[model samples]
Target: MNRYESMMNHLLVQFSNTKVLQAIFCAISDELQLLDDTFNNLKEKRWIDTGEGAQLDGIGEIVDRNRLINNAITINFFGFENQINTTGFNQARFREYSEPYLSSTSLSDEEYRLILWAKVNKNNSLCYMNDTIKSIQFIFKTDIAIVQDIYNAKFIVGIGRKLTKNEILFANALDLIVRPAGVSCQSMTHFDKDNVFGFYNQKFAKGFGQAPLSEIFSNNLIKKGYVV
Candidate 1:
């Protein structure tokens, strides 16, 4: 039963059937429901996944303090020398590569939440190689490869085609933001069989002259998305 019915049920026996008292209790019950809804909304504001609007922004303040935007921006006040423009001869047009970049404005509610959640996991949880793999799986729920090159002090993240533009940007920046400092990160498209160099007993292993040369810099970097 709703609040109105529950309130009427508890009344003293003599007052239970009174129409005047029943009307007053019904009005009070409606007001109490509005408070219940507002209270629940306040409770949801504590989490990034459930918060909306100002509540979401409040959560962002704690997790994403820097408010890093999905896309990187480069600005140049002066025009570049010797740049050709087919559309027009305007130097201003040639110098400006894209529209002025706005921070934290281009992303949607879900995209913003994704960024915040990733940072939240990174700040609160383990961040080793395996942890990074698990974090990617939990945050993205897609096929991603994390290749570690300890000798070179670098790791590469291979993102598949399922991510959004903002997601791709966040994935590219994940290393610098989440991983230990001094480790370089390179994010790129997923490596296909043709782009990966192979070794003996490997998924894409090839003989000396049996297959074409691959463009990947190292054999350890590619092997069907496994950590090597």
Candidate 2:
């Protein structure tokens, strides 16, 4: 078996063996030393040799792994209530529910806007903005209607923002999926390279219309429309 499988099996044995548990408690300090040695040997040699090791590449990955491990350990070692009290830990509890929404390719213009708005707001609940409410109230707001075409169609979600150096670095590092409203090729030209416009223009023309960002946000475009 692999190191991971071995470790899991060892853990399961430790849990099931009352004699082993009693022995472990009696020799807790020595047991920890042995465990540490065993784990050290099991860890990837490359990770131990390299200074950087197998450290996660991004914060999101780190957070996600932490969530996974925390959940597993808690469920195995303690009961559900004993789960760590942390933002991402609690967030992980409902992760299955959030996964579909996070991975969703189909959403209406209003729904897309609401999702972006929720990200910007950094709130748990999806709520509509006054402007968004007004827009929905005035427009058809149908699932069939493309939001990008109906609206100003300037901003593109999931694009790197160029507002400031810190913002740029943060956006790049986080790989954020949200951008400012009304920010388009014309508006971004002053800061970004000309190629940015060309890339997005081609992307828009290929299947998406003038408002590529809006088209991407639209659930209909991704789910049923011709746009790939």
Instruction: TM-score each candidate.
Output: 0.63, 0.18
> In model 1, what are the clashing residue pairs, if there are any?
none
Per-residue CA lDDT of model 2 for 31-111, tens digit only, reads 665777677755643221221223321222323311111111111111134122213443444434233211112333333
Span of 10 residues, lowest total lDDT, candidate 2 = 67-76
- CA lDDT of each candidate? 0.54, 0.30
Prediction-by-prediction clash tally: 0, 2
Encode model 1's per-residue lDDT on 1-228: one tens digit a residue: 767877888999999899999889877999887787788787866577787667777787777534455333222233333211113345344334454421233456676777777777788865577766666666666554555554566666553224443343344334323565566564344444543445877554466766644322222222111111
